[model samples]
Target: MKFDLHVHTRFSKDSDADIDAIILHAKKNGLDGFAVCDHDVTGGGPFSVQRAAELGSDLVIIPGVEISTSEGHLLVLGIKESIEPGLSPAETILRARAQDAVVILPHPFKLTSHGIGYIAGLDVDAVEVLNSRCLTDGPNNKACAAATSLGIAQVGGSDCHVPEMVGISYTEIDVQERSLDAVLDAIRQGKVRPGGGKTPKVFVMRQMMKNAQKRTAKILGLD
Candidate 1:
């Protein structure tokens, strides 16, 4: 099964993509499933799953969150409860593990994206080596190399904040079943491969500008 294990929805303060629109776009892009790892929130995932069911779509929506840990950002998939932000990476990972969630280090070398910078000694289940939002290949390459060296599973995601970017990058998982547990297990067991092209720089730039505008508007109380 192919899954874009990193994506954001309106639940993420920096994103405006609606769950419905995200689902349709993911289906159109030929993805089997996608994880909703909205920043600091897990509600988007279950909300997306429910929306998909309401739309009678078969795409699986794995519950997840993008945690803003002290070290950087981390992806926790198949989590039921929300993990608090600003905790240490180790603490965050420990909480996710307590929930039997799968932890992934995303853009671990992308300085501008709050990447964690180092991969050694982290107890993550996988590493995102093919983040579509990475305009340059250096970060992704470094992540891939690090994962390979550590014998850790490598995954991919669009890290999309917009609907159009859905499925730009995905993880090809070898799973016999289409359930959430099956997919998570596949990822944990290294039965996955990263695939897809980079997200167009123009789209990325546009989103960044929009985010900046929103922040500025909030600061000015004009939102």
Candidate 2:
């Protein structure tokens, strides 16, 4: 099954794409499934999953959240509840594991944000090796090396907030079923493969937007 493991919807304050729009784009692109991993929220998961079902589009929606940890970012899939940020990466992993959710280290080697290096000693289920927005090939290779050294599964995601960028990167899992649990099991069992390469234009635009948002937050005293 082809799945885009990381995507953001309007539920995230920084994104403008809605659940419906994301699903439509996925379906249009011939993807089998996608995850709605809005930052720190699951408010859009059920809505997206249900909408996909209603459309009879064969698009499986995985409930997930991209949590901002003190070290870097973590993507928790197969979750249905909110997990507050500011926790250490290890603490966050434990909490998510307690809820039977799968933990993923997102862009650990990326220089701009909290990365896997922040919680290197902690055990994690998977690591994202091919993030569509990775600034350089060097970091992507480092992430792959980390996952290999840790003996954890490696996956990929678009980390897409914009409509046009969906499916730029994805995880290919050899699973019989398309359910959330099945997907998580495949990842845990290391039955997934990553695929994607950086698009120069998209990479630059995403970074610029991130910087602008950070500056805006700082100015508003919201950072």
Candidate that would win on lDDT: 1
Query: Each model's TM-score?
Result: 0.98, 0.89
For candidate 1, lDDT tens digit of each residue in 48-84?
A: 9899999999997899999999989999999988889
Give candidate 1's whole-model lDDT: 0.94
RMSD of candidates 1 onward, in order: 0.8, 2.5
For candidate 2, the per-residue lDDT at 194 reads 92
Positional deviation of residue 105's Cα in model 2 after best superposition, in angstroms? 0.4
Q: Please report how far candidate 1 places residue 223 from its true position, in Å.
A: 1.6
Screening candidate 1 with a backbone cut-off below 3 angstroms (N, C-alpha, C), the clashing residue pairs are none
Residue runs of model 2 more than 4 Å from their true location after superposition: 203-207, 210-223
Among these predictions, the greatest TM-score belongs to 1
Note the Cα lDDT for every prediction shown: 0.94, 0.81
